[model samples]
Target chain A: MLSQENRLSFFLSFASLLGVLLIWQFSTLPQASRSPYGIPDGNAEYQRLMGRSAVASTVRSDFPTPGAFARNAIEVLHAPFHNNGPNDRGIGWQLGASLLRVMIGYGLATLVAVPLGFVFGLQPVIQKALNPFVQILRPISPLAWMPIALYTIRDAELCAIFVIFICSLWPILLNTAFGVASIRREWLNVIRTLEVRWPQRLFFVLLPAAAPTILTGMRIGLGVAWLAIVAAEMLVGSSGIGYFVWNQWNNLSLSNVILAVLLIGLAGMALDAALAFVQRSVRYAE
Target chain B: MTLFPFSRRPYAFRAAPCDHGPALACQCGSTYPGIFTTGHENGLPTGAMSAQASVPAISRRHFLGAATGSAALAGLAGLFAPHAAMADTAPSGVVEKPDLNIGFVPISCSAPLIMATAKGFFQSEGLNVQLRKTAGWALIRDKLLDGSLDASHLLSPMPLALSLGLGGNAAQPIRVATMQNINGQAITLALKHWHKRDPRDWKGMTFAIPFQFSMHNLLLRNYLALHGLDPDKDVSLRVTAPPDMVANLKAGNIDGFLGPEPFNQRAVYEEAGFLHVLSADLWDGHPCCAFGTTASFAEKYPNTYRALQRAMIRAAYFMQEPSNRLEAAHIMAQAAYLNQPEIVIEQSLTGHYADGLGVVRDNPRRSGFSPYPYPSMAVWILSQFSRWGYLKENIPLQETAQRIFMIDEVRKQAAALALPAPEDGQNNWPVLTVMGQRFDAFHPPSYSKG
Candidate 1:
């Protein structure tokens, strides 16, 4: 299916990747030394065997070892059923828990934000009145919400969920309001002339016209939700990927910590990709 | 089951060594000769277990004679004998369950776990126990619900919290089958915060705690209130995870923290903070940790539950041994979950006690040592829950307290082990003082009301 130029470019990229890997492998081999242009780095292999190395290497065996880190990453990508020991708190379980929390929190936020956004968008006076309060809370870092959420709410899991909701809600609400308010004057006039019912206008004309903006808002909100979940999990200290990473670090198990981090990044990518796909599906109508 | 608490002995039941042909081997790669039989026992089942059961049959004289050739025979025997006998003399109705998975936190407070496993106390009870170190209390609760762990070393208020349906958890009837430990927790004040106030003045300073719902926080609030300081109006109280407390204090982020063991010791060693008050200071000799299980688990496995308690009691006795402290610390260091420096663990595991107010006292002080399961402690926790707003008014305190602690079951287990029984049936035990004036008894009702 590919053109000649495209096929050649793909091969070139593959060859470049192979070349880079070989250079990296050889540079890290036992006898390799730093060039005179830069200072000669000490023997990492010696330090690894001596166990009297820096705390970072001693704490995490996989540290400063690209190959080991890569292997760990590959292993984590197929976790849960793939793990073969009593201590394997898998990457997949953590990813699932994080996603579930994000969805529940983001869903709740949308339930409240969409309706409130319409009200604020339709009535300028109401929006103006609420703007100050919204501005005050919206820009506040979501992690700051944890203390009040826990003490007042007295539940860590709920607190984490609430924080995710707080962080993700603002962008969606603001964008939805902007989308609703910016609907063309001609469209409203057409509805008014035709005597279109308010509900009908909202369901048909307004939504379809504002769909692009709302989709964009959702994309932004989902990204924020993903960010908030990781930070919240780290703070909340229950069973989550964030806790798993922190727990590994405390035990000085660096390979697992690095593995968890890769999982978090991959999970974030998948979440954003899904949101992007949905946004694209809605774009043509707008 | 018996009522009395057992002596602090590695093995509760003692019997004369059985006279067998040769000493039996163990599956743990050690030759424990003259302990149990190597082959079929009195027409019992065949296999290494029979070998294990009969190894104890060897006489004292034979045990000495076999030590020379024991290692070679033990390797061959280890191939056959699958288990080591737990008790010197097995009691009737004692071997209830053969296998169990118990939960413990990977803190210095979990000395009983390392001690029990190392000394083979659980093996004596004919049980194969797995000690799982859970992440935190909440996860432990969930694991209990899902049957991941049969029992757990839990915070004192956890059972009461579950029963009251607090924190939006469905009401799961919880029972305290036994008390695992008592009186090793301290409230550490960050050095910067301590410098900001007079040593005598504990008013108007923010303190960090592990959780808002924890007993340490409640006790802190009560202690402040008892001194005429309003906890809400006087100072802000923040929550920090126990491990993070030391770093946060060193960075001058928090004023003080309340936690159990080594973390407190670590803070002092780092010069990040100093002990402000022992939790026991507020309520003299309070219970901090207990073996908690859902009532469903208790109901389903009554005999298994008793056996678990017997194993825990034997483990507790092993931990108190003066000679075993170093080994216990080493075990903790090597454990996958704990894996901290032995010095840090030893500092916390050392049984020496000191009041935050600079008063020193001996652990297991003859004046007040209540390690046995008691109903009064449950009642005390209930009163505290009501004292705070966690439980609504008009709950039947006595009935709920009785339900939470299976005093009769614990007594039965204790009596079977030949341990000391509760002298007074849940009487008003007096509060003893290490930091201040001493007393023999306390009025639980008035103490809460005040």
Candidate 2:
């Protein structure tokens, strides 16, 4: 059912993934024999305790192999909703908490950005006045704002949400403004001649014309939001995927950290894809 | 649907007492009413009270109702029963604030606080505690000052530093309720330096400490100075988070670190570093961490403060027993507390551990749990503050120590728990020997004279 081009691309993607996994598996394969470096002489107990003895092969490389990663991943994914207590929840719960925080922060950013972006697009003078401030604030890293946010907000949960809101705000605002300002003059003239009222002209005319561009901006905002939430959650350590990564790091379980990194990537990709689908749906023939 | 077939059971079912083991199952069915009946009684041991109070139970009617998609509702009722029962029985006006938020860093130093929560010491005392696991010491300090935390696990010198307004902190009066732990830190070095055991040979190496105000910094500086190497000029010391210390060592960013265990033991477990020296070797029976609260918090909630102090003291007494240490380690290693491997925590707590240099050392004094807040310990910490140039102004050291450390209050609480209190005179203010140098508590040497 697939075309030759599609089949070729799929095959290439699969082959590349296989190649990477194969390389990972080979590189992390334990050495057949390890040199007993610094193993004190005549202390068989010491050598055994240090995993240098021939009988006990407890010493492992710091990096997890593909097989180890797969085993850890299966263990983690097996019970994704088990809630042990406040500090230890399942991976599914962590991801859900992070996603919920992102959605709330992203929603608030959208609520603020779109209306202000409309005003900026409608008035060139207003846009020129605010442009410097927006440009200055946009380049500030989300982490830079964390301490200040924590200090001012005085609540860890709100501070994390505030960080996400700050990071995601600029992209959507700029994109919506740009999209609104770039709407064709001919359509505006047509609507003007028809004597459309302000509300209809704004919603029916302006909204549809700028829908794709606004969504493009929202797509970028969502991407930035997802990125910011992980860093935020890492700083505010109660519950989330970022906290899971940090807690596992505290335990020195590198495989669990790697698993979290993969989950974060997959979740981010899914978010972007969902927004892209919306963007496609709102596109016009013109 | 196949991904999570267990999802059909309410999420609370996972936390059901039955899921824990057979030991908890017997308590689940029989002991619910006994807790409520005994809730009004005073002077009962906290361990017994909590053992009875901790079992969340489903009533017979609720259990039958839970089968009809009401499991979560029933679970909520079961969870609220203990608090409701405690509130109803709490002699009306005694505990002003029954609900409390206590913050702690996820380290072995916070073992007593973690154990108190895990073993339901707070619940037995008619207090509902939410123990917030904070990220770092700075966040802990900030949260404490901002009133977000009722009390917290602090470094032994943190309350003093905050009280004196040292290290960019506002001069706020924070009181040390009880000393958390003693002699639980170590200087761990990367494996590359295993051969270079002597400190004099190491000139250009960088070391990491948990905080500038921490005892780790003072002891490390003292150790380096004893070796005739200036800590400031000969070596670079970086401030890093405790959790990141092992990763930083493994990445070769730091040559060594004088940090709190289980990080020191964790580094050895990961095979990234070897223990160069335990802090116990530097200063035997040194105070490391404290349990404290703001003076205002204690003033407003006096009864609650007393209850909290008693619970912590009892927990510390429980931890003092060598036989109880392994079980305590297992309890603290759960994901809600330290979130570490049981063996790593066991090695740190039980003091029987491999020293990463092909030696299995058994030293019971590795980490001690003493709840006493000695005034002399604060005096010694202030002396170090002066020694390290952290105290620019010459404040009254003995007066400040007396004011900050609630020695009498801790002694009273320990007495109430029927634990042995330190005797008068030499026992309370004994001379401390540090790295073969005598430090008299009565007459402190002037570090300002160099």
**Which candidate ranks first by TM-score, i.e. highest?**
2
RMSD in angstroms, all models?
A: 14.5, 14.4
Model 2 off-target regions past 4 Å? A32-37, A41-54, B1-93, B423-428, B448-450
Model 2: per-residue Cα lDDT over B273-292, one tens digit each: 87877665566567899999
Per candidate, the number of residue pairs that clash is 32, 0
What DockQ, on C-alphas, does every prediction get? 0.08, 0.29
- Model 1 spans with C-alpha error above 4 angstroms: A1-240, A248-263, A266-286, B1-102, B113-135, B142-149, B164-171, B194-200, B279-285, B351-371, B389-400, B418-442, B445-450
lDDT of 2 at B450: 30
For residues A132-246, could you state the per-residue lDDT of candidate 1 as single tens digits? 9999999888778876776566656788889989988998899889988998899889999999998999999888777778878888888898888887877664456876676
Question: Alpha-carbon error at B356 in model 2, in Å?
Answer: 1.0
Q: Give each model's whole-structure lDDT.
A: 0.60, 0.76
Candidate 1 CAPRI level: incorrect
Q: Summing lDDT over every window of 10 consecutive residues in candidate 1 chain B, give the lowest-scoring window.
A: B53-62
TM-score of chain A of each: 0.78, 0.94
Predicted structure 1: clash tally: 32
Evaluate model 1: give its TM-score.
0.55
